[model samples]
Target: MDTTRRQALTLALASAAFPAASASAAPRPTGVEGQRRADLGDGRFLNPVLAGDRPDPNVLKDGRDYYATFSSFQYYPGVPIWHSRDLVNWTPVTAALKTNIGNVWALDIAKHNGRYFIYIPVLVDGDRPLRTYVIHADSMKGPWSEPIDMRIDNMIDPGHAVGEDGKRYLFFNGGNRVRISDDGLSATGKIEHVYGGWPIPQDWIIEGFALEGPKVLRKDGWFYLFSGQGGTAGPPTSHMVVVARSRSIDGPWENCPHNPIVRTARRDEPWWSRGHATAIEGPDGKWWLVYHGYENGFRTLGRQMLLEPIEWTADGWPRALGGDLSRPMPKPRGGSGGAHGLALSGFSPDMFGTKLAFQAPRGNDYLDRVKLAGGVLTLKGQGSGPADASPLVFVAGDRSYEVTVEAEIEGDTAAGLVLFYNEKLFCGLGLGPERLHAYRIGQEERWPPGAPIDARRLHLKLVNDENVVTFFHSRDGRQWTKERSFEVAGYNHNVADGFLSLRPGIYAAGSGSARFANLTYRARGPSA
Candidate 1:
């Protein structure tokens, strides 16, 4: 089909799939309601171009399609690259980095001269030192090259750009930039101060001035630099998006007249600490901004991906158009193709290749902790609970959902599924040799007078709706009984220091191994 005809068909399909008026419906219990674009069955659509816990987003438009990825700190099988044609609905194409590359942070994904590369800045575990690495792929899809240490120490965010002199460069935290070789693999020059980020007025309610996450975009003969400042966490008013631009890549850059393009000025806002952004043009040639923010009262959900439209003023600076981004906006135009989200249903061996991963394992051989064979996931015991076990997990966006798994305990091991946050804060259910363990506030409690069960084969299910979690068990697949229920709204950042979410996961801890099968997960949407 021709380009114009294809664009029209895409628009028609999106309109039918998402209607703008429908997109503005009453907010759902999950708080993500009325955020998705109305598929008007035409190719064009509405807002939140991407969804879920996809924070610190960095997108690269390659040819006719766009590829994006985000911070996958602690989560191995990290940096899953998503592809989108329309920018509204995205599908995971491949997970670029499989090996544990430290605690991954805000990264830059870019393409130059027909080659794709991802510059990752990570926080090393033992030393707590910061380092940046580069990984290359001939095509967006694997096989990708192993990570090459960039040797640019103590950096967190790596923003790639091409200099006016044709030199490759990367701008990192603290407004520093280092030159890279033409191969785009290693650093060649010393890190130098290039741009001084905007300053926040003192006495203003804010987090600290932690100036970081710089993204550079070359547009209309100008080099635009976007950065996040005022700390990422703490006061709801902290963290904000700022912009600067210069005629030269090596600049005397000027800050935006309206320095903060986006920020959370009050606690009443639906989202807080909103910053760390990357700007890109929509398929229709319109501008849009992608960033991350902590959902109000859902800090345990971590920083979620957010989208806002951008309007370029006559003076050349761009401003976020969606206000607080708590409401819906018109969708991007043009382009067709790509799926909206990931589905986790079927179980099979080798499935861990991408869909699931452990959060910051002690070593690379952590995969040895679990055996995936014969459609069952057998995990060895580790630590005492979900906190230490490095439970295998996946990204989930719904406020309420149910997860079920069949497990057969062997040896002296205990195994079950859990909603895990960190070592000090988390809650869920677990099954052991003598009794079913109910976990709340990082401690396990036994209930129902505690009945001992020797059966090796058992099914477990957890139903979590709006932060309240209930557990269930069954000896046979047909008959079911409630095990226990626990309220877990407190399993969040206020109690835990890590800016992590309470994730649904499966874990094994004790001495032996537990075999798991028929794992199923389903989300209860707004109506539920």
Candidate 2:
């Protein structure tokens, strides 16, 4: 090989090696696996505090601790709740809901009367409309109860609230509220339309006047209702946070003069379609809003979790203090922990639901396909290929990162790594008995089919630099050969129609089994 080629392969070798003990801490990437971190380690922090498809964030503040979760969609062991002492730093402490109820949507997490409850709104099927369910646990790290059917029909987002009458309530989409029992298990009263949504100007462009995500905060005798207006996605201007306030739960509500508290005004901004926010009091006595937004030009990464500050106006209205959020702002005080990601170097069994998950989980039976033991994952393959299989995916929040894994195929299974977005939309290379199946544009694109493989056991490496992707192979885990390079900037929600990110996935498809060992993931610095 030429000197230039040899040097490039050598550098790749060094970076792909599992991070070893070293004191060269000359400003390495902060988060686990060198992923782009939110905390800058200089007191300030950046947007998307928790990255990679963390949409519809629900944050609950309990004394000095904060527990947060998001919409899990089709992934099993859904609603993975993360624990944080500081809002900026978080780690997945547990997956609250393990049962496959349905396609989970926006939810609300609240602590009521010394017990924790999660109000989940799910869409089962076309014949059965959307319904709400409730699950509770004594602690954030939970043995959560199975979902209790609240019989809340036709609702997509459910927010919990407490009234002055010492009663519990839940607010739903389209300006409606329902009374709940004291135990926080089921709905007690009829759904009542409380207030109409804020009107948008006729000249503005938006997907729809869809009003949803009603999170209530009672402060200083005034209950603030923050809801999202405009559709969740469609236009650059779609989706925003609007607020209303009422002195009592009984009504006489008024809209915040500064309606649409936060929005993406232009297509050039860093974050777009920003909505579904939860207001939380910072540990340091300050106030902040935990929201989600699509990182512009990187929507394939999905709606990332964002943190911004909010201040109460002199006129008693709360206003978002962070500007367009194109740059880093001063972080809120009192959060203390590691950045939000888990390096997949070891599997403690707890890793299944916490950091790694299966997409489009059919049921608890899908769990039968995977076996984790001694840091090696032996996956039994099902389906003809990745499109039919429930691929194992993990959280990847970095703009640039590398995933390396050693695979030994058993039977007819095609085992390999991929950047997966749902079952229908994904791109990656799969290794079968003695051939490579290169996937792109959501399906196998085997035109220049590359060279043939002679063995079933080999080391695979995938580098995602920005949105451009490259795949390589190594026989002895050294001296890698580039298989191909492609651009994946379009592999996102806008292109695929699913609110899913391009997460690194492990797929075992076709026949027998695939044993994955020595898998390592590390976020990369800027292209060198």
Candidate 3:
């Protein structure tokens, strides 16, 4: 096939899957209790099996159960595990890693001989080099062991596989592999470059030839490797899922004839940068691919988990069947179902370790500074504001939602709620007893005509209607005052550096401790 003509045909095939959001006659995306739910309840479902910043999803199928975890960068008690029976509907299980490992990158999860393993890549800068580690557990709901140093060079996104000779291997980003010990505790050798990667067209608008996220799927006497090429967050058509396979773990691999199985061929598509794919055998004995993609026009949500059904070719190759995946598709058969997500109603101490209900950045050491009891969260203040205080944040999946919290300042402490991407890029309203503190993009100032705040207590609420945010404060729970509103569409990875989503959270700053109560979250449909 002529290169240019072949690429055009591929793009055409990709576009055929996408019907504009309004073009489809199928029922539009509906919600359950104001929250987005994928399963339509009529034996059909939508894309984004799990929303929010669930990028680089790694799922391990165990018997009748399915367990998954995503790349949790800087969120402590990292690599959150989710449980699913039907695959479409999921709930939080437990976070695997407790200790803070550098900036967590793409990872993979596998169950081997009754033990579960998660291959983690930590991105380190300065004088140190990038390193990958492994964590193991006797059970999914873990008492997981401390991360063991894999001690390999030039590796990221490690995928586990077993060779014909019965030796265990970890396939890494950029087509590399390393041998693992039988105990699965440590690395046995140096990393070796095996497969180069699929050749990409020079004319295609992509981020780069950044081939990474290698996941191994073994079935019917073949070891199939699914990987992401092109940069993860660049052009709309950049990131993609490509497949290659070998009879033995070590071999000259063959790329799928229909390469780049899943991609966002155009910017107008429903999802963007669709890649980092992991294939699984569905509940109905059908093959399915699970990957991550940025929802079109909403990069602030980060990359979300997308489920696409796949078909196997007669010549023993697989192809993704989900077109641009804008429309609802029939649900998979056989598996059971349940409610989809966790409730961020308040600080649920019971759901503490399992769900990242509230997470701190950089330092997981801040737990010593927090006390949660009876619907109240008290924090010992640090630094001066959200930037240095190391706030406790949670990802808000909905494009529009409302968050309210009541804070009682103790001594000099100031606490309130805000939408934070990182320390540098955040905006919120805080209480300082005598004055109301408003944090704008690059500067903090008083909300002129500063209303006096009680040192003892005040309630703060934020409504993010799309990217525009409005702050309201109340002396009593019912009586509210709208302080100000600002635009926050730029508080995302594209504007900010870290690969992070803008999250809703609270912070405490100053010398004394601050007590927070009535932290409630409600999702509203996107504003007109």
Candidate 4:
């Protein structure tokens, strides 16, 4: 076929896979402007109970309250705990991992012996030779213990379960299992293959048969192993949830008659690759499934956590209630969480005191490198560029928000605000000693010659109006010039494969130091 024909065919497929929003329609509200809330306020809640990059959900039911956490890859202060009582409304409780362990993936949060534990498997800086680690806390709002490397090799997701025999075990991808110690801190027995996951049809168009993320639930004299298959993120149709049941936790697992309890059969669905679910009994004793998926055309938001009701058949099988989940359903009955989600507005009176966390650093030294005093944040520059500089970053869950910061470089340093996803993918406008620097898709691009850069102090602003980021700069706080604009819907795990979220942050690169001030964060429009 000719190049033109091939390109046209590709475009057709792309359009079929992801339907574009109508041009004449009003802009859909994203990020926290009373939009994307799972609680619909009419006793009907939406599918995505929690939105924005919350993947590999592990939900634990503790008394009347429910605690949940996601796989926070490469984000320091990882595994943020969220609390919800009604299961529809959630609020961020606290971040558990303060120190960087690595790129965390498919973690399991469980309470064994009245103590909270998060079983983590990470790539250790996105390198090969994966390892599993465990962290524990006395309280959910922790004082979480430092990560203790379990040293388990070649594992991605660790699903913790206690057998009827009262022994703890972790089920992994590729139908593997390993025994855990009595304290749930270390692996005990040899890793062995136990249950072969439910087989996907050979003709199915899937990314891969990578059966992973086995969340085990033991109830009614049966051990239900819920596993995700067809790869995590690739084609929109890839990734799904399949269930297998067994009388004994050891062996002889049978696939569910209604296999694939949840899946994105079509590419055009609102939520794609819907899998990795944690089946939990809601506060009212009704069973529900919480999973993650990429919002259609908004992959940069990462896989937002989704909640759907489930029903059990008389013959002992679970079925998902809400279909495709493009709309709202009845809210979960019973208790209510105090509030759901965080306020996106971070603008404070004092810019120097802004809550900041460095990107995944090699060590704990980044804290010492940052100093705040007299309304200025002095950060020592590091790395050849932003990818390794460990730019100070914070999580913003809004779909449309603007952030601005005034930065002054000391010596050879170049510093400015950025919309960063990870080391591999990011874009923004910055200033150096000589000229303006533009970063796109993890690489620095040449700017137009003769852009003004005489003044040492530069004010940089990033307006992310629903993934469309516009860059602006100003010498004085009053006058601003638009530098550039770029759409960043692809800077997420589906394209970059980092399982990360697009975040607004500040970075200092090259030698010397950079002083940043007047940092402000405010949510913008889907104008009414």
- Candidates' TM-scores? 0.87, 0.91, 0.90, 0.87
- Clashing pairs for model 2 are 86-335, 86-336
lDDT top scorer: 2
Ranking by TM-score: 2, 3, 1, 4
**Candidate 3 global CA lDDT score:** 0.77
Compare candidates 2 and 3 on lDDT and give the better one.
2
Task: Mark the regions of model 2 whose C-alpha exceeds 4 Å error after superposition.
Answer: 1-34, 335-345, 447-452
Predicted candidate 4 versus true structure: per-residue lDDT over 129-246, tens digit per residue: 6999999989987878999988688888999999989999988989999999999989899899997888898877788998998999998999999999998889888899999999
How good is model 3 by TM-score? Answer: 0.90
Count steric clashes of candidate 3: 0
Tell me, by TM-score, which candidate is best: 2
Task: Estimate candidate 4's RMSD in Å.
Answer: 9.3
Ranked candidates (lDDT, high to low)? 2, 3, 4, 1
Candidate 1, residue 323: how far the Cα is off, in Å: 1.5
**Cα lDDT of model 1 by residue, 192-294, tens digit:** 9998789789987886887788999989889999999988878889989999999999899999999899999899988889999889888889988888887
Error of 4 at 381 (Å): 1.7
Which regions of candidate 3 are displaced past 4 Å? 1-35, 343-346, 357-364, 450-452
Distance from true location, Cα of 467 in model 2, Å = 1.3
Model 3, poorest ten-residue lDDT window?
A: 5-14
What TM-score does structure 2 among the candidates reach?
Answer: 0.91
